[model samples]
Structure formats: C-alpha cells, structure tokens
Target chain A: MTDARRPLQIVDPDDPRIAAYRGIRERDLVRHQKRFIAEGTSVLRVLAGQRRFGIESALILENRFAGVADILGMLPAKTRVYVASSDVIDAIAGFPMHRGVLAVGLRRDDADAAPDTARRWRTVVALSEIANHDNMGAIFRNAAALGADAVLMDAQSCDPLYRKALRVSVGAVLTVPWHRFGHADAMLDWLETNGFALAGLSPRGDAALEHWEPPAKAALVLGTEGPGLPDRVMDRTQTLRIAMANGFDSLNVATSAALVLHHVRNARTGPASG
Target chain B: MTDARRPLQIVDPDDPRIAAYRGIRERDLVRHQKRFIAEGTSVLRVLAGQRRFGIESALILENRFAGVADILGMLPAKTRVYVASSDVIDAIAGFPMHRGVLAVGLRRDDADAAPDTARRWRTVVALSEIANHDNMGAIFRNAAALGADAVLMDAQSCDPLYRKALRVSVGAVLTVPWHRFGHADAMLDWLETNGFALAGLSPRGDAALEHWEPPAKAALVLGTEGPGLPDRVMDRTQTLRIAMANGFDSLNVATSAALVLHHVRNARTGPASG
Candidate 1:
C-alpha cells in the first residue's frame, strides 16, 4: 500500500490551512462555517470511526501522534495530519490542550435526507430550550451510554457540536446521530408521525417515570432546567417524572435525562433488574 | 421581638467583618479556616434553616435583601447582615454576583457528635478519591434530591463546600450532611460498623446494578472518573456496575452516583417502578 497519509510537521502555528483550529474558544462563539472542532483523543477516535462527518484536517502534538496512528490511518489520503510541538499546538488552540489531539470535521447539511427510522432508530431523545452547553453535552454522553438511538433538538437549544460540549461528551456528540428542527411542537409532531411516542420529562408530569414503560419507538423529551417543558409542549405529550424525595424535587437536567433514558432502555429490553 | 438583627449598609467592599467572603474563588483554593461560603438564595435558605452550622454573617445586594427577608429573619440576633450595591458585592466576590446572595457558614468541628442515624438516615453515600469540585457538588445534590441521608468522602476528595461546588449544587452541598474520613477503607469500615452494606460502584463490578438490590442500610461508594475504585477497596466490598450500552462505558461520575443512588433508594423504599 502507498504511504499516502504521512504526517506533516507544522513548525508555524499560523499555517493558513489550519486556520479552522485557531482561538477555539472565541471561534466557537459564532457558527463554525459548517465545520466543528473535535478535541482530545477519545473525540478524535469517534470522529474517525464515522464516515458521515468528513475529517478535513487533524492537528496533533508530536508526542501524541504515535498513540493515534491507527485512527489517523482511517482518514482519507487527502486528510492533512499536522504534527506540532506542545507549545505550538497550545498556541494554535489558544489553550493548554494537555490531551494534545484536535480535529476539524465537516457536517453534512442535507436536511432533506430523511433518517432511516426503521433500521437506525428505536429510542430517541428530543431536547427543548436546553441552553447550557455542559448540560447539552452531558445529555449526549448519557444518551450514548444508555443506548438511545438518536437525539433531536429544537433550534432554541445550544449546539451540541460546541467545543466544551464535545469535550464534556467525551466525543459521544461526534458519534451519536442527532438532528435539529425548527420548533418543539414540530419535533414532537415529527416523532408522532414517525410512529414514536413522545414522553416529556417534567416535574409536573402526570405519570411517574418508574411506572412508565417505553413503547417500541419512544422519544424522551427534556427541557431547560428552571422553566422546564413549556405548557404547550407538555399538553401535546405524555408527561413523566422521576419521583424525588418530597422536600427536594430538583436534579440537574443531565442527571434527570440519564435516569429517564436508562429506565426507558431497560424497560424496552427487559426488567430494570437485569 | 426587637429589631436587633438589622441589616448593616456597607459602602466599603473591603469591610473586615466580611473578610471571609472576600476574593471568594481564591479563598476557596486554600481551606476557609473551618468556614464555607454558601451562595444564592436557596443555599442561604438552607443555611438559615439549620442551627447545626453556625451562621457567622451574610452579605447581600441592597436590591436583593428585601426579597430574602424571611431567610434573613431566621438568622440569630447577633448575626451581621451586610448590604451593599451590586458592584460592591461583585467586587468583594472577585466575580459577578448576579444572584446577589451569599452567606458565610461555620462547619461543626466535633467528629464525636454522632449523626442521628436512628431516626433520620437509612441510606448513605461514601466517595473515594473524588477530586473534582463539580462532581463533589453534583453528588451532594444527587444525594439530597434522591433521599440518600449523608455523604462521606475520603480525605483525598475535594471539599464539597468550595464556592463553585456549593453554587453548582444549588446549595445542596450546604444542606446535605457530609463528613471527610482519613481513608477509603476506614470510611467503609465505619459504614460496616454502622450497619450498612457497602456497595462499591465499578466498571468491573461483580454484579449488574440493575439486578443488585440494596440492603436495609446501604452505603453506595463512588470513586473518581478514571482509575475507578482501587482494587484494594473493591476487594473488600460487594461491587456493582451500571450496565452501560456496549462500546460506551463512560458516564460522568456525578451521573453514575445519581443512578446508583436512585436505584438503591427505590430498591429499599419500593420497586424500581414506584
């Protein structure tokens, strides 16, 4: 086989080709021009595992490149693998990236291509107005760990592809299949049309989470922390709540999502007492 | 009753009486000299509700003081309540004080004052090597929200009373009864002596968390994110796993604690479907 994917030494941090990876925190504030930064070895591995997200280029600290050769080999011959010293890599990213691995992945913008629900999805998550990046990332991590098929978020929700969220997710955000829709009601309606039961997680839910079993196809809905699911959304879906201790009804939304997702996954597969 | 607990208006942010609250973040790095800062209205409420933790003083934004009259009224007559402009409060904190509510609480020093377990506690959580402040805070929040009676962390763990932790926990850190012990084994031994079945959470656990039912008095032990519970500790107790989805065995430590704590709580009180 031809050694086409040799690593390029990046002595200068300001190389124009690697501009997509500069000042990551500030750059993440605006839309990334259809590209997302995947940080750390774990996230890079996930990004390399999938073909849907095209790997445009990778910047790695020289010391860490050897550890990730197998993953790098998975990329196309055109993919630029730029190797730099620790200081150069840190300078490029504008932060101390001790993990020493970063990659830029391109997103597929084809909204018209419908998801193959029958084969690819069964249990899905729908998030409404989840503004916190950490919470959004944690939800993706929980969804991946607990066997949720995909995630659907309304436009109001924070972008799961944001740097901190991607890092917090341990790269699950890169691997998990997720889509964004315009409105909460439209997302719920889409799930309904696709033969999925929409279960909205709320403090004022009518059914206790422990008693609620997932249908063959279920969409677990979560909302922002304090305001929770809007009455309009709650009115359209079956509401469920994790029965908390009487005096303390609050749990971080991510923790709430994990418990709910785990319950749904277990309920569908078998009893909770596996 | 006399208006002896009147709020004192302080224009100077450098007032020595509120020195415990100065440079809050930096002060949190070193120990608070046996004191902790509780932030936000909710934590202040919990601080005021308890007599066990001595309320040394409170600092509030002038605009927010009227909103917390009930909580302020609960403080002892000698407790000083300092009121200042939002800018002064922010400057004093070395950060923006949007919530505009803060209180300094003194932790009880006597380890011999045994916990009133006979009437209040049936379930407890013990943590080993949990160094993350956010994780510690989340665990405290989870413990309080899910009915776990107390938190026992090994000395290696970060302080739960750190400002960020206290804030992240939404003041749950202040409300949850917790203690730090010398070693992991010693804490576990103490739990055993107190009639608790120590269940250590590990990825290599001998039993699946779904099938493992908690005993009447269970102590759920959690470790740090990576290099989970040490084998020495795991060898001494019944170990259990959350049974994550294949290929993804990761969940934030706080989320893991929440799930295990929820399972143990429900198992003891009722079925998982309660």
Candidate 2:
C-alpha cells in the first residue's frame, strides 16, 4: 500500500493524535456522548463495513496489524490508523486489552433518522428500561441473528454502542438497525398506529408462547431483568410468556429474548402458520 | 426459631470456622476440589432445598439474617451459620460480598448418585468443551428454566460448581442435574444406550432447527463458540442449525441453547406435534 494509505506509526502512548483511544476503560464511561470503541478483530471488521457509524481512528498492536491488513486496507485514506507496541497500547488503554485491536467510531444520532413505522417489517424488537450493557448487547446479537428487522430501545435503556455491549454483542450492535426513543408510551403508540401487533414477554401473560402466533407484522417487546416491563407498557401490549417447566422462572433477559425472538420468527414461517 | 437454628455470631474475618469463605475469588480456582460457594439469598434458598448437595457452612452479614430466616430455618442443625459485620465479611471475601449471604456446599459425588438412564426424561442437554464459566452457568439456568431434565459435559469442560458459574447461573447449577464424563465418545454411547436421539447444534448442520422435531427422548448437544462441536461428535449425531438472517450467524452459546430448548419444548406440545 502507498505511504498515504499506510497506517500511521504511533510509538508514544501519550501521542496527542491518538488521544481518542487513551484510557479506554475509564473513557468508556463518557464514550456514548459521541463515539464507541470496537474491540477484537471481528468487531473491527463490522465497524469498517458499516455505514451507520463513521470510523474516526484505529489503534492496533504492531504484531496484529499484518493479520488485519485486509480489514484495514478497506478503511478510507482519511481514517487514521495508529500502530503501537503492546506495552504502549496497554499503557494508553489503562488495562490489558488482550484483543489488541481497537477502533473509535462516531455514532450516528438517531434523532434525525427515519423511524421504521413507514416500512413493512416482518419482525421488530423493542426494549424498555434495559439498563444492563451485556443484556442490551445480547439482545442486539439475538435480534440480528434471528431475523428481527429493527430494534427500538426506550430512552432510559443503556446505549448499545457502549464498549462492553459492543464486545458482548460480538459486534452485532453495529450490524443491527436500532434506535432510542423518548418513552415506552410513544413507541407503543407508534407500533399500533403502524398496524403492528405488539407482544410483550413476561411471566404474567395472556397466552403461552407455544400457543401465541406472531401477526404478519409483529413487534416483540422485552424489559429489564428483575422489574420486567413497566405496568403501562404491559397494559398496552398483548402479554405472552415462555412456559417454564420447573417452578423456577429465572432466565437471563437475553436468553428470554432469544427464545421469544426465535419463536416469533419461526412462527411466522412454520408449517402450522395461518 | 430455636437456639440451635439461630445464626451464630463471628466477629473476626480470620475465624477458622468460616475459612471456606475467605479469599473466595482466588479460592474459587480450587473450590471444586472439595466445596462450592453459593452466593445471594436466592441461590442460598436453592442450596438449602436441594438434597444432592450438603451445606458445609454459611457466612452471612449480621444485618441480613432476618431476611433469610425462613431459608436458614430449613438448613440442618449440623450446618454452621457464621454471622459477621459487612466489613468483616468483605475482608474475608477479599472483595465486597454485596449480596451479604453465602454458603459453601459439598458436591455429592455422582459415582454414588443414581444415573437417570432408567427415568423417562423428555429432554437432556449435553455440552462439550464449554470452558467459559458464565456460559456453563447460563446453560444450567436455561436448562432448569426451559424444562431440560439434565446436563452432561465432557471432562474437559469447566466445573459447573465454579464460583462465577454458580453466581451467573443464579444458583441453577445447584438445581440442575449434571455429570462430567471421561470423553465425548463415552458420553454419546451412554446417551444412545439410554435411548436418547442426539442433536448437535452447529452452523454446518444437516437440517435447520425450525424444521427439525425432537425425538421422544432427545439430547441436545452444544459446543463452545468460534470452534463449534468436534467433527467426531457432529458426524455421529443429527446436526441442526438455527437459521440466521443477514448472513451474520453470531449467537452466544447460552442464547443458542435457549432457542433450541424452547423450540424442542414447544414442538413437543405445539399444534404441529404428532
């Protein structure tokens, strides 16, 4: 590759040009304000491939660069790529980043992005008060893998672009189309107005998931672990539950979402479908 | 409650009576050699109720004793309950034990325990090389919640009784019946002899999960992420795949188990069932 297109060598951990990649773990707290840190080679590939997020810069350990040359080669010439020694990289990140691959990407604000209500969707996932980063990431991964067209999280929900969430989602957080909305009430209203059937997963539900069928256009709504969906949200949507065999009803929110999303996706195309 | 049932007071962190509770995060590495630490009130409840495992001792923060009185009352008189200040408990744990409740239980050797081969089990989950404790724990939680009867892991798999696994499993590790066998071949042979139809989850499967129906007695086998089920095992069993959308087939092993288990459970009872 030409010098202009080659990755910039970053020897000093304190280099001002690569300041955006410094103290990643501590800096992650405020990362949602503008940018996201994509870790690991797989996540970085997704980051480079996606159009929704703009790559600001990449910091990679010297040894790992050759292995990821194909991915790095795809980046725009204007995108800065900082190569550093493992020690320098560790010093800048404030913790041992074993993955040795990092990318800072600017998140596209959804405030001006068009809502999915106008488009015909087969399956959509909506979340309320999903504050946990891992759970949020898992939900995005499940949604992306299970054929959900879009994801909508309430304003109170944790950002999917959070570094831990991004890593846990296996970079599905970048691949999946998602938006953050103002209120559960407004999102529910929009779904109904768009001729979409809303089904909320809860222990207390009107129908068992095995018996419930997703409408042609359905939005599966899920909530946080302990409290579940708010009373107002549950009241508006048709509540559905995965029947637990044992007396224990404990399931991680992400697992529950996967079960429900898989069921809804297959229910639409299964042999017994109406 | 009687005096014998009341929790005993232990002021010092170094008290030998509660030695099992000391430096738990580090002690966890070798905890499987003799005892397993069960954390939180919910997990403690499961430990107290189970017959397979025997509680060695319990360490509790003095103030939280009243809340878990019912669970404590169920424990055998022989089981010692040591109560200390939150600070003392934290010091003993080498970290903040925010849950304020813990129990070290002796794992019942499966060699003495009766095998469930004769028992007519509708579903069983088998795992191979699941080194990740959180994934192992999550699988146990899913199996317990979703109606799988038991879990079988290869000897190479991480111990389910590991502390982090126990915590992530929400104590489902205590509730679910599991066994670690010498090799995959031996486990597969035993499963077949027990009349189970083995179905291994893999990206390169013969049939899609949505279309496949579980046999009357089914054993759903799953492997670790990235490097999936071994070719030896996959060659022997019926291979299955969860159809992914957008060509992005990334689902956490635990979430994949949830999807497969949910489908098999529902398929057995759904309208399309035989």
Question: Using Cα atoms with residue i matched to residue i, what is each candidate's TM-score against the true structure?
Answer: 0.90, 0.93
lDDT of 1 at A204: 86
| Clash list (residue pairs), candidate 1 | none
Instruction: Write down the lDDT of every candidate, Cα atoms only.
Output: 0.83, 0.83
Report the Cα lDDT for residue B173, model 2: 83
TM-score of chain B of each: 0.91, 0.93
Model 2 alpha-carbon drift over 4 Å, by segment: A1-5, A9-11, A110-113, A116-118, A271-274, B2-5, B8-11, B110-113, B116-118, B271-274
Tens digits of per-residue lDDT, candidate 2, B134-220, equal: 899899889888888888888878998888888888888887777777898888998998889999999888888887878999999
Model 1 chain B: ten consecutive residues of lowest lDDT? B110-119
Q: A218-246 in candidate 1: lDDT tens per residue?
A: 89999988999999999999999888875
How far off is residue A200 in model 1, in Å? 1.5
DockQ of every candidate structure: 0.53, 0.53
- Enumerate residue pairs that collide in model 2: none
